[model samples]
Target: MNADSNGLSNAEALSRLIKYGPNIFRDHHELPLLIQFLSRFKNPLTILLLVASAISAFTGEMTDFVIIMVMVISSVTLDFVQEHRASKAAESLRRSVSVCAIVIRDNKTLEVPLVNVAPGDIVLLSAGDIIPADGFVLEADDFFVKQALLTGESYPVEKKPGPLASDSIDLQSATNAVFMGTPVVSGSAKILAVKTGASTAIGAIADSITRHPPPTSFEISTHRFGLLILRLTILLVLFVLLVNALMHKPLLESFLFAVALAVGLTPELLPMVVSVTLARGAVSMARKQVIVKRLASIQNLGSMDILCTDKTGTLTEARITLQQHVDPQGNGSERVLELAYLNSFFETGLKSPLDEAILDHKNIVVDVWKKIDEIPFDFERRRVSVLVENGESQWLVVKGAPEEIIGLCTCYSVTS
Candidate 1:
């Protein structure tokens, strides 16, 4: 089938729609409410308490049964309410990352739901665009994509229209194919959507990121303690029932007495205490501008000896500001900014935070400057250079890490 700027015809798009379903990836294992509630019963302490309550009710000790039931209801209800709120918060966060994209269909470029993007559709991408689907580069101009989500490499990867001879190439080396959720670092491209939703490489990685329980030491110790208590409660209850029966006590009285012993031994109030404390902790965290997605995580967090993670969107706000531009001898210089902005503004490569900051500073009219050639930034080179021709003069501007930028200099200029 031919694919172009017009993309697939309406009939063809519809046909593929039926075949591929939608461009959406659903996390496959969301437990139902009833199952979630039932899962709480898996705890040994909860099971033992429940059994004691049943024995109390069976022996017609309605008051004891009612008291135990109240505790169980209070504990479970608090837990359920807290977890439900947390789940909703997580879903809202996910929605922000999954946004719409523009695709060409029937000769018209239109913004559509990301789910509606299908293979063979033409995706028009520009700088700062977050790619919603994987595709082959049909056309490109100095395009660079940041695939850190997939490749874990901080440097942006350049892409161009080319033929791959084999399927054995690694994803980072697949220079011709674009992946979903990666941002266009700079430049622009007309990409033909080859994979969408779960079929893309990033989608597969996301699919593998199932919500498995965190391996917290506190949880492990708590579980082991519960089992130890379960064993002790069983032995104590059995011994009491045997002794009472041997003494010719009434069966109902003996059962009731044994149930009371089990209740006392099982730490029946612990669950209620934990639930209330965790809920309070969650509220406290929210007040401090920290969102605790799982209330149970509070205990795990408290028990953490050390925790390490990315600082992006966590320790630091993602926004960056241009602080100051200066020359040698610590003198403020507009020329430093002028040169930096010109280098940033003229280059046809991926823009960095430093570049954005420089561009956002007081703008200079560059209508007379003609961009000559650009030397793109790479980790090895540690810089980007832009040469521009203005009137009868031409100047080369370079920007990069401070150490690297200084290393290339033979002389320093100090504003007097």
Candidate 2:
């Protein structure tokens, strides 16, 4: 095979890679532990509580000040630790899903790290492989791709190359195009990489995950509750200070009393409680084989009214087994198995799952046969025929969908 016939020369690929960054999915890293701790104090209530703790220290109330400091530090540390662990756990998962792709680079076939793939490079895809970048199909053989990870549709979709009649089309409907992160269910394809990194369709979806979503119902309710408590605390403190002043109490004493009262009224532990709860939920999910990247998503999961997903790879174990192999006469036939095994082993294009199933029989063997020529399977023809020679004898074996192949058969072999 000519190296130049496959894809870009090495120099060209390197130049394009320099122009466009490596293919990668970008994710937001969590803030530093110290920064996350400081973030806990960003809220008004936490700040108010800190001020009270300081005032207590200044007034020589050592016991109260120590208790307040301990509460603040304990809450901050718990929240920070849980979040840090969750972030690290999610990172491991992201790394696990990262895959490498086979490409033609410098005119030679190479299995490069997926992240190094650049736009315009040629990639070869086959069954059980994951696509690492977006591209148009240059050539295909019975190519079918399962993009349920992106489209939530379990059915494997066939891919083609011609331009659509209308430009307005959904990704699932784009037969001529393939996107990153999808699995090749069956068949094989040669693709011209056109997009990578943040520019690919899946990259856009990954970007969406980073941009924070609108506040959920639980968050809205929590915000309202915080505001309500803040308003009530302000009113109560004012009332107490006004009473002390009316009774001619010392100004300093009244001020300190009001400060203490305000601190007591505020729900300083709300944030801590929420964080711990979410962290625990994340831990539980991890134990049950679910990875929750964002802590806030736990609430959304609980509040979700409708959840929809495919069962093919999720709810059950999907596997193919050679349950039974029979001939036209409705009897088990070693001859049928032998012929099918020869077809699958010799006539290779994009190997189908059925071909795999047929080839799995332990008793099947075809070491004596040699392939001479093949009638390449095509969309319109819908059949594949292979001419094989065993010693001096040569015969053509054909297989396809029953509807398409039935008319071509004028005679039936009903014997074993």
Candidate 3:
């Protein structure tokens, strides 16, 4: 795609849409019809039922044939309808890309649709904002992002403006790269777009969903069982035919008997049973906190020997709280507690559990502090220092990990 003086040219944007837009799973009103048709004969039990019906028809048993055929067709039709409804509901839950973004173009900031945000666009991101595109950070201030959706990490990742090592950097370690779907946990930033739409990291996930292969287990099992039944039915039919041939019996009568045997050998209820089993398993799992996005994932989960999972979100509560406070001065230096409360109260960007606990202090009057200078927290420093001016005096307040803060001060607190 070509870039115009403003950004992407009209032709370029159209070309990108042609290449990438079609891949996006936009909600379609006709999706229900498509899903219904696809669901037929896809389940194992259904396959067996259909095979049984075919055998009954060949046997010349009109009553039995009609009954089996009706049952098979009705079951398949019901399954198709249910699947169609489910697909339509899933489509309704898909996130929309209707919001416009404020981006810098030719040293001028302009608002444009998120879909039109091509690579190399400078996007302005702030606290509580969802990243619109994948990009490299050019500048950031106390920027932290929650990447649980992408990496399954519950903790907010601290981001910095620097050149990331392309060879060694993975998505989690790409300190410079900001991705779509993740929200800015705290602070603001200016980022240069590296990828957008289908080319983005999240876009890769969308592509995986689109190009997913058919259910291997269901297909293989149904085919195997069907072949076995077909072989048995053929043998039974041959035995009857041989006897009829030796006895000089009527050919029509013998053929009808063989067809009846074939029909009985086929398992017409197989599809319905398999469908019910899978649906039951899926519903049971839903009752748990884990949501199985793909139905086939249930089978895959069973086959896994060892699962390597991210510990951030899945294992941790995603909240950091103060477990203990040691006031060694014995004078009950409430000033430290008060200062911590004031600093947390003024911090409008990030809201962690530690900040919540500090805010809960009843004795602290954080609003009394006037205008002042403050230093934002950094992962490397592990501390946040604030200089607040109250009347004529300026108080230097600091809060961080216990070890880091204790190391900076010479005094030690002894418990009674």
- Worst 10-residue lDDT window, candidate 1: 310-319
List runs of model 1 lying over 4 Å from the truth: 1-5, 27-31, 93-98, 163-173, 211-221, 245-254, 288-293, 308-416
lDDT of 3 at 297: 50
Candidate 1 TM-score, true structure as reference = 0.74
* Backbone collisions counted per model: 0, 1, 7
| Ranked by TM-score, top first | 3, 1, 2
Report the Cα lDDT for candidate 3.
0.69
Q: Report the lDDT tens digits of candidate 1 across residue range 112-146.
A: 77888888889889989988788899898878998
Measured against the true structure, the TM-scores of the candidates, in listed sequence, are: 0.74, 0.72, 0.75
Winner by lDDT: 1
Best by TM-score: 3
Q: To one decimal, what is the Cα RMSD in angstroms of model 1 from the true structure?
A: 5.6
Candidate 1: C-alpha lDDT: 0.81
TM-score, predicted candidate 2 vs. hidden true structure: 0.72
lDDT of 2 by residue, 245-265 (tens): 999999989988987787677
